[model samples]
Each structure stands twice: as C-alpha cells, then as structure tokens.
Target: MAAALLGGGDYELQVSLSEALCRLTPRKDREQRTNQWFSSRDVSRAFCDIQDRDFEVDCRHFLNYVNRCHGDQRRVHTFPCLRAFLDSTELFPPKDEKLEKFWVDFNQTSECLSFFTDDPQVPSLT
Candidate 1:
C-alpha cells in the first residue's frame, strides 16, 4: 500500500506520522508525543483490505457528516476510518481543551501537509 501511495505520484497528501503530530502539538507537550498513537501497519492493512473505489469519496462524506456533530473536535477521533490516516496522542485527553485546538488546526491545515514548504528537506511518510 505504501508502494502504491508512493508510486501514485500524487502522494503529497501522505505526510509522516511525526510531521502530522508536530503541527497539532506545542513544544512543551512534545515529550508526550509517541509514534504509537496510530499504527501505519493497521492503516495499510485496512486500506488494502477494503474493496471500494470510492473510499476517498466516502471519507469526504464522513468528514462532512462529522463536521456537523456537536463537540466534533473530540467526536472526530472516535471514528475508525479517519484513524487509518491520522495519528493522535492520548496525552491530551478528550476533556483537555487543547485537544480541541489540535483537531481544529488539523482540519484547517491543508490535509496535514505542513512540511511542503520552501525547505529542501521534506519529510517522508513512514
């Protein structure tokens, strides 16, 4: 699956786990960030096992569905489909106000591709 995504050439959407988390977290909470929040292996397995052509379309639909929910910032984390691509931390529990900021920033960002800047050292999705 990684090969497919990498070979697709439109993989600009694929950002590393760390890169995604770093944008949602502040420097002080950096120590709490762990790569184990969500497993890439699980994502690869789930994505590969699915036999649907409209997965991306379904995802967009789900996003819109969740966007209208009350307390969507915390509610967004409970779904399994989005979990496949997103990496999150338990350090900031659902009750933590910071978690709201994290999800808000994540949603506002360009599909979590913050590393696509003028810098030459672009991070890879691992």
Candidate 2:
C-alpha cells in the first residue's frame, strides 16, 4: 500500500505519494486533508529535503488549493503549513502578493486567534 511506503525513508516517493493522495482525495474533503498533510511537522520538514521538481509540484498544489478555497468561500486552514514552508524556504520571498494580502486580512478576522490559541474543541488533523 502507498501509505506503508511513507515510512520507507524515501523522499521522492514520499513527495509523490503525498501529492497523489491529495489529488485523489474527494473534492468535498480535499481542503481539510491537504491542510492537515502540509501542516504535519514531519511531512513539512521532509518536503524541504525533496528535489526541486517535487517541491514545485507540492507548491503548485498548495497554491491551487488556496485559490479554490477562496473562490468557494471556504475557510483556509493551511496557515501553519504556509508558515512552515516559508521557514523552510530560503530567501526569494513568494512572488504572489495575493497570498500575503489574504493572510493579512485573514488575521484580522475573528478566527485567527484559534490558530495560535489551542482549544480542546478544535481537533487537529495531524
């Protein structure tokens, strides 16, 4: 099973499988799952070690998902993922200002505090 290979210590396979899983996920639940995967500490750290091509694929998927989330009026739950990615990536800030602006606006919204303040009611997907 592909899930079993996740612990095989293969970075390339991990990246591929992670992307494939997200792509194959049902549309109705894709956003939450995608956010969970990227926000996972181990997965996020492993992504930083993958090849450029694989990294780009993951980045593209995240960007597309964010766009869809916004257009569908869905809440964005990948702030931790984005933060981790930014921390892992060196120099050369993201060119997309929209993403930056969205984060800024999103922070002003009431739900932003939940991301920092841990609540027992908010179940973590990770």
Candidate 3:
C-alpha cells in the first residue's frame, strides 16, 4: 500500500495527518498555516492521538497493539463480499472513538483507494 501510494509521483492530495485532522475538524485555515513536514516524534504523536493511549501501531508493539481489533480480521469479518471488503470500514471499526477519526481519514484518502459507507454493526445477508 505504501509502495503504491508513494510509487507514483502523481499525487492528487498532499496533506499531513494533522492537516487532514484539522480539515475534518472544520479548521481548514489552520491546516494551511501548518507545514506539511513531520518528524518522527510528530508521527508518533499523531499515531498516539489516533489510537487509544494504550495502543501503539508500531513494528515493535504492533502485534500486541491490535490484538483485540485487527484491521485484516475486521475487513474480512465486516466485509465478507469483495465490494464490502473494498468499500467500507463499518464492518471493521476501531475499538474506540480516537480510532474512528483515523478510520474516517483512511476511508476518505485516495491513497487507501477505499470509500466510506454506513457500516452497520452486523453484516447484511442481502
């Protein structure tokens, strides 16, 4: 995914996580004010802000981090059909609210090549 996103130098949108957060928050003015550049600490801070304080999405702690709510597992469970799998995260929400923003941003991103849909708790038979 990272390779594909960065592989093509043709990016339609170039914004940082914080800036995206700001825009989602209805603060586009602030988004333009901040620089797009991010340091390691900034990345860490953004990750922490998105995840539960106790959770960390890093290589070292990732296994334990998503133990309860795995992205891959959620995709499979929530999106059994190919369309659902590729279409939404309603079937696979983060464990909490902080994670929701991350999911929303992810779904809205062209890079992820996914979409946002009303994710009913239970997958539909139809």
Candidate 4:
C-alpha cells in the first residue's frame, strides 16, 4: 500500500485498500461508494484546480473527494496532497509533539525558496 502511494500508482487502489481497512475495523460509518473512480487526467485536473486562489472552490473539491471516501476509516488511503492541504489550512487536529518533530525534520531536509548564489549580477543579500 505504501509502495503504491509512493510510486504514484492508481489512487483508486489506495482508496479500495482504505475501504477494506474500514470494513475490517468498522469505523463510525460504512464505506461510501461515491464516484471514487478517478483517472490520471482527473487527478491532473484536480491538482491544477487546487492551486486556485479561491479557498471555497479548493475546499469544496477536497471535501468532495474526502466525502466520497469513508471518513475515519483506517483502511482508506489518504493522498499526500490531501494531507498537505489539511496541514497548510490547519483543518486537521492541533499539532502535537510528534507533528512538531515531523515539521522540524521536514523543514531541515526540504529545500527552501532562496535566491541562487551563482547570479553574479545580483548583490548577495548576506
């Protein structure tokens, strides 16, 4: 499951896995069978649309996807994009100690948007 997610394979497969997990655990609600099917083009369109400045549109699209899947289902595979969106919007639970540690590690490892040093024409801010 992790491999499929990391490899960017069929996202529906991930959603199916999540549904299976939910069935096994029996969360608050049963698995929703909404239009869970998505093609690569659909994903691409969603990816582009999410970048829109209108938060309402973005949130609606995101919630539509989430609602299509069973909420609180352990087996439901959450896309990394959803996780990122939730994190950035502070929509999820409050960040705990572990989350804080994750942020620290992520910030340390990820690249920052800084000016390149090779541009000789531009004066160095430092």
Candidate 5:
C-alpha cells in the first residue's frame, strides 16, 4: 500500500490524505501560528516507519498527536484516513472546546478526495 502510494499507483489515497490534512490544518496568515505541520516528506517517512513497526500503535500515537494538537487549538493537520479511523473507533481524546472549533473549521474545508468511496483495496499493515 505504501509502495503503491509512493509509486504513484495510488493517487486517490494520496489525494485523500492531502486534502484531509489541508482541511484540518489550514495555514494561517502568519507563520508559527499552529502546532500542526505536514509535508510529503513527513508522510513518506511515516509510511515507511509504519511499514516496519506496529501500524496500529504508530497510527494511534500519530492520531493522538493530531487530536491533541487540534484540541489545543494548534494549526496542525494529519492524514485523513487516520482521522477517519479515529472517528470510527472513538479513539479521539476527550473533546475540548478549543479543539472543537478547529474540528469544525477543518470539516468545513472542501473535501478533495473520498477514501470512503475510493475502494482502497490494500492489505492491512498488521
């Protein structure tokens, strides 16, 4: 799956993740405004790391970080699939008013991709 994404064979996942992050962490007018940051390099590193380590654990930790930042009102974003997984499993941390605002704003952003309907057929990393 990672290979397919990185190799350009899985553009849908790439697009979905990218759109999700942007929605979750829109850049502020000024720099150093938010705690969330992401890039292709970070995603690639995370993907490779997950391939070698415990994907569930890594994903949990990663999502926790993202949720924490969101709660803290930090301007950060993470992978959409991770967020979706967290939402589905109720794994997100206790809600905070500040984070709720971020979540709402994040959700308001345009959705550029849809993993829910794209039919990602990759094998589970576990």
Candidate 6:
C-alpha cells in the first residue's frame, strides 16, 4: 500500500489488487460463505503474486484501510487506489457485510463481478 508505493511495484497490478480488494471483501455475517471463500481465494492469489519484499507492507496497508473502514457502510477510500473507482460509480446503497455490491461503487452495491482467475478458460470467483 502506501509504503509499497515507495518500492515502485506495478501500478496497474496495484490498481487491480485494489479492485480485487473491493471484490473480495465480504458482507460480514450476511455474506454467503461460498462467495466469501471464492473471493478470498481469488484475492489471496493476486495478493500473493506481489514481490515478497512488498507483500507484507502492502498487506498491512490494505488491511489498515479495511480496518479503518470497518463498520462503514460505504467503505469509501478503503484504499488509495479506490479514489478513481469511487468517482466513476453510482453513489447509492452503501455496502456492508450484509450487502455486497461491486458494480455501483467499491463498497456501495453488492453486485461484484469475479476478478482474478486461476485459469483464463475458467470463470473467476462468482
């Protein structure tokens, strides 16, 4: 995250990771176990690919954002990369552990699409 930015990791990858961050986030107790498991797996995979030197730092940054936004329905600004995403999406229906929305906004709507996939031929975490 912030510290990793200093290491000059792949920008697009970080952006995608940020996007995956949003997608993988679960809707708390209300979130479906199946979806959570799948999304977690996908997110973890992408996260793991980051350089080992930066993984721990980035993970800490990502988790900090998550923790900062905890209990926040909108979950806005959970990551630095989320700013652009937030502006492009619809502003309604704040997301929560009970509501999973990815289309409308980072954490506002529960319509997240599967992102990272192990195989191109296979569908992602849906």
Give me the candidate number with maximum TM-score. 2
Task: Report how far off residue 61 is in candidate 2 (Å).
Answer: 12
Q: What are the runs in model 5 whose C-alpha is more than 4 Å off?
A: 1-51, 72-126
Model 3: per-residue lDDT, tens digit, 1-126?
222222222222322322344334433332333233222344333333443334322311321232213344321111213233435543443345433332222322233443234556665798
lDDT of 6 by residue, 34-68 (tens): 24333454434434443334543454444433334
Q: What residue pairs are clashing in model 5?
A: 34-75, 36-76
Weakest ten-residue segment in model 5 by summed lDDT: 100-109
- Against the true structure, whose lDDT is highest? 2
Model 3 residue 87 lDDT score: 58
RMSD of 2: 16.1
| lDDT leaderboard ranking | 2, 6, 5, 4, 3, 1
Error of 5 at 117 (Å): 24
Clashes of 2: 0
**In candidate 1, how many Å is residue 102 off?**
24
**Candidate 1: misplaced stretches above 4 Å?**
1-51, 71-126
For all candidates, the clash counts are: 0, 0, 1, 2, 2, 7
Q: Which pairs of residues have clashing backbones in candidate 6?
A: 1-58, 27-97, 28-97, 100-110, 101-109, 101-110, 101-111
- Candidate 4 lDDT, tens digit per residue, 35-95? 1333344443442343224433343344335333434432223222222233343223233
Per-prediction TM-score, please? 0.20, 0.26, 0.20, 0.21, 0.23, 0.21
lDDT of each: 0.30, 0.38, 0.31, 0.31, 0.34, 0.36
